[model samples]
Target: MHRWMDGVIGALLVLLVLVGALRWVDTTWRPVVVLQSVGPFVVIGLGLLFVGTLLLHRWWMLLPVGVCAAVAWAMALPTFFAHTVPGPANFTVMSANLYYGRANADQVMAAVRAHEVDVLVLTEVTPDVVDRLDTAGLTRLLGHRAGEAHADTFTGTMIYSRLPMTVVSGTANPAIEQTPSLQPEVVLTVDGQQVRLKAAHPMAPIPDQTAQWRAGLTALQRWKGDVPAGDRLVLAGDFNASFGHPGFRQLADGLVDAQRTAGQGWVRTWPVVGRRMPPFVALDHLLSRGLGVVKAGDVAFHGSDHMLVWASYTLR
Candidate 1:
């Protein structure tokens, strides 16, 4: 019986290692992409499996499990170390998905006030939710606004800023043509400096929508590439892809993940309300370039499944 249990544990560990390896593959397959989002958990599972192997006296399996866990840890190590440069916090941005316009507007507004947010990006916004947010004093707090609110679908994204801003045409990449979500870009004048911000809501990588999801991330990558040298850019919203996804990694290549820069390890920000389990994967992000990250964190609201992600940065 002990031998059989050891064999079962070994098989599970092997399967987990294979799943963990998917993070390196740049594929648009729906299942693989979804599985990749749990890469961090896979590392944790490997560690648990190593303990199980040891308890079962499976010495042979220990070496492989330990090595795989080590490799996964190494890959994720950078996010655990602080990379922020010293600078004064001149900007604070927050992002959240409204869960098809069901997120608590008052709670969101309270977060903005508490964080002293300079800019707010919201995804899955609807016309009704926009009205509710306005009633909650969003416009009064952040006078400048851009992006459209859709009534028929949850494709809407909006960016509200305390500073002056103008709606700008987003990337003309054809890949975005198939994306179901609306990605809006805006230019804001922060302390006499032009900063570009985009509210990104990529299609989720589910069956039949994997292609669109990949396209959405690809379009964001194109947008990043199109930015001129020395220009600051911030892409904030429900990206629908976690750091484990290759497409997201590509989009984030030249950008700084605010949470990672602040050395926040394994920060999960999704399914905080509806799921039976606690939040497990971070689907929202505030990725930027040409900025100094001061701090970052997430706050849970009443209705949305996703926690609001906020980051303080210095306009370098």
Candidate 2:
């Protein structure tokens, strides 16, 4: 009976190792995307396997255990190292999804004022919240802005900046029906530098919205702004997808995630379920191509489901 039980444990360990191997090469299979969210959990399972093998005095079993542990670490390696950020930042930026107007206006504005955020990106905007934002006098700090108040749905996206921003002609992508995912291009002249900014919130990656979600990320990946080659480009918002997702990996391959650059990728900013409970995922982000992140992190604000994601960058 003891021999049988040992055989069962060995088989289970081999199965877990195979599952970890599949995650790296199974990108094309859509259903396998669900396993992407559990990459970190695979590491936990590998640790258990290592401990179990030692307890059974099967030293030879360590070979498979080591191989599986190495695979899991490689899958999660990007989260472990910090990308170098050089020089002093000229300005700071922040992004947040306000839970469809449920976030506290006072607290939101307070964070803006306290952080002195130069650029603010908001997702899931509503007419009521827009009015409250205007009333809170954030315009006193952020003078140039663009956002159409949509009363029908939580599809609104807005960007407010301290630098003068002008709408870039013919910059909107009309194929995207989801307003939050629509990339609104604006050129801000900062210290005589032309900085192009775009805010995007892709469709959520739930089972039913996979097509729409992929489309949203694809649109952003294919988007080409009218900015000059020398000008800076900034992409910031709640992408609804993380680095683990294939779509974000494609889009982010061309840009640098500020949190990842600053070694703060583990600081999650969504589903503000509780102060003590760690967030299940990090959904909000700030990305850029021509900027270097000087500092980056997130904070929980009152009433919103998402914590505010903030980053400071220097021209690169």
Candidate 3:
């Protein structure tokens, strides 16, 4: 019976290694993408399993488990170290999902005011929610705005800025077709510099929506690649994809993840309010280029399942 249990444990460990491997491959399959979202946790589990193999005297399983754990750790280690470029943090940005317009407007405004946020990216915004936000003094604070609110569905994305901004149509990427949610891009004039910003909320990779999710991220990658190397760009929102997803990694290639740059290790930003379980994966992100990250972190609000992700940056 002990031998059989050891065999079962070894098999589970092997399966986990396969799941961890998904971080390097692109796939639109629902299960694989879902598992990949928790890549950091998979590395942790792999480490624990490697220890278990030794503690249980499963010598035959030691080599495989140890090697896989080492590989996973090697890949994940860099994300924990600060890569901040030296500069004064003159700009602050925040992204939040409104839980289909259910998130408390007062709480959201309070966060904006507290952070002295220069720009705000919002997802799942509805017409009524926009009114509530204005009522809560959002317009008085930020003033400039772009993107339209959806009256019938949670398809709206908007960028609000204290600096002057105008909505710009994204370069049409054929790779993105029929995506379920709206991703709005705008150009903000900051200190005589033009900074392009996108409020991005790609479709979630649930069972039937996996293909659209993949396309949405692919579109983002193409959009990022098309930007001139010298241009400043920022993409912020509930991406619905993590670093584990190869598509996300591709999109993030030339950009910096604010949280990673600040070395906020394994920060999770979803399911903070309505779920039975604690937040396990980070679906929200702030990715940028031509900006020096000074600090970054997440904030809990009253009603949204997603925590607000904010980052401070300087011109690079």
Q: Which model scores highest in lDDT?
A: 1
* Candidate 1 residue pairs in clash (backbone atoms < 3 Å): none
Give me the displacement of residue 274 in model 3, in angstroms. Answer: 1.8
Residue 161 miss distance in model 3 (angstroms) = 0.7
Provide the global lDDT of candidate 1 against the true structure.
Answer: 0.86
Error of 3 at 300 (Å): 1.2
Q: Decide which is better by lDDT, 2 or 3.
A: 3
Q: Please, what is the TM-score per model?
A: 0.93, 0.86, 0.92
The sequence of per-residue lDDT tens digits that candidate 3 reaches over residues 1-316 is: 7799688777878788788877877888888888887788888999898888889888877888888899889988887899887767778999999988888999999999888899999888899889999999999999988777776556777788998887785322334633556777888887888889987877888888888888888888888888899999999998898888888888889888999889887879987986898998889999999999988888999879999999998886
Given candidate 1, what's the lDDT at residue 75?
Answer: 79
Ranking by lDDT: 1, 3, 2
Residue 195 C-alpha lDDT in model 1: 90
Q: What is the lDDT of candidate 3?
A: 0.85
- Name the Cα RMSD for model 1: 2.1
Q: Local error of candidate 2 at 299, Å?
A: 1.2
Considering summed lDDT, which 10 consecutive residues are worst modelled in model 3? 169-178
lDDT of 2 by residue, 215-304 (tens): 787777765333455668888888877666777778777687888788764556767844576676677888787877888878887778
Ranking 1 against 3 by lDDT, winner: 1
Q: Residue 76 in model 2: shift from native, Å?
A: 2.8
